[model samples]
Target: MIAYSVTVPKEYGYVILAATSTFFLNFWHGTRVGLFRRAAEIPYPHPYATAEQISSASPDKKQAMYLFNCAQRAHGNYLENHPSMVIAMLVSGLQYPRTAAVLGAAWAVFRIIYAVGYTRADKQEGKGRLAGSGFWLAQLAAFGLAGWVGVQMIMGQA
Candidate 1:
């Protein structure tokens, strides 16, 4: 029997670290989406929920819930797409493990806070957009780091 040897690039370790961060962030986002969905399925605040809670809810809550669902879907897209992105960087010989890990962790943290602020906010006072922006910034940072690493690899600086 011949055993196949999988060759991991020098950047493979960094990519794996980044993948860890992505996993955490996705889990956080998935939880929020699940909570929102569960809330929606309930009888408008359900049994234990207060009337104030129900009354204060904006009609846009539905939209917010939908957005959470979208985020969950987006998470899947990232899972599928991010590996290729990382692979591209790796192929370019660019790998920054610390940057990838940190960005991933930051993104995960931001998304959790964002989801809380987004879903629990009063309808008249929506904070989902702000939360969305924070997550966007985190994502941008991750991509930027990836780009920097790629450039270094291409320039033979990696």
Candidate 2:
């Protein structure tokens, strides 16, 4: 029989905290979509209102639909990039724990900015682009860090 002990570094705890932020953000976004769905009077299994439906909707209904679509898109966009960023953050933590944690936290903040901006009444695109750029930069840094760590491990240098 063989026994092994694994001890995670204390710094990785910060990474875990950062990872938690993303889940909270996801929950918030999903909740907004649900709330908007209710406001729009949209039933389940109906992803979005049809063009004809929107055309015939009252002003308030139209606004609700607009908001609902915005919420849905925000959640969808977050889903698109979240998995890769999380993986990179964890992998980068192997070699650069503090840096990975910083990037992960910053990524969550950027996502917050993007989500809020995207759900706004005016100029969602500008805000999304700005904050989204920060997240993109964070993602690129995490990916580069992870790649370096992977290569170092392969070369037996890490």
Candidate 3:
């Protein structure tokens, strides 16, 4: 077998944290889906359904399920986007631990909160939207941090 280097750059620790956080978030969301499925057997209003229809649409299991699935998808997005940033940093040779840590922490917390808010199933719709938006914003921050790292690395100041 050909020798392969399995070493990850030091900066990759934060990337690992981000990835692990995504997994936890997904796990929580999956639990939400399980709860929703159980409740769904009795019929519930779908979150995506019309407001008026929600009252008559079986009590909203579908919507609850949607939040769980969507949160998982959001984590998938984080996983996808984070690696490119890590690779870019590695290639450019720029590693900023402080920046990465901040971004990763924010993203992780936002994602966790968003998942919980979504799964709660009793929060006001407005609150859920706000929480979810915060999660997205955190993701955007991670992207920005990664881009900055990549840029600094490319500039040879990394």
CA shift of 27, model 2, Å: 0.9
| Number of the candidate with higher TM-score, 1 or 3 | 3
Give the local distance difference test score of model 1.
0.54
What are the runs in model 2 whose C-alpha is more than 4 Å off? 1-7, 124-130
lDDT of 2 by residue, 1-158 (tens): 43434346779988888888899999998888899899988888998766777789998898778777877887898999999999998888867889999999999988888777776766543344355568889989999999998787777667
Ranking by TM-score: 2, 3, 1
- Residues 88-114 of candidate 3: C-alpha lDDT, one tens digit per residue: 333332355545555556756766665
Which model, 1 or 2, shows the larger lDDT?
A: 2
Best by TM-score: 2
User: What TM-score does candidate 3 get on C-alpha atoms?
Assistant: 0.57
All candidates in order of lDDT, best leading: 2, 1, 3
Number of clashing pairs, model 2? Answer: 0
Candidate 1: the clashing residue pairs are none
Worst 10 residues of 3 by lDDT: 85-94
Clashing pairs in 2: none
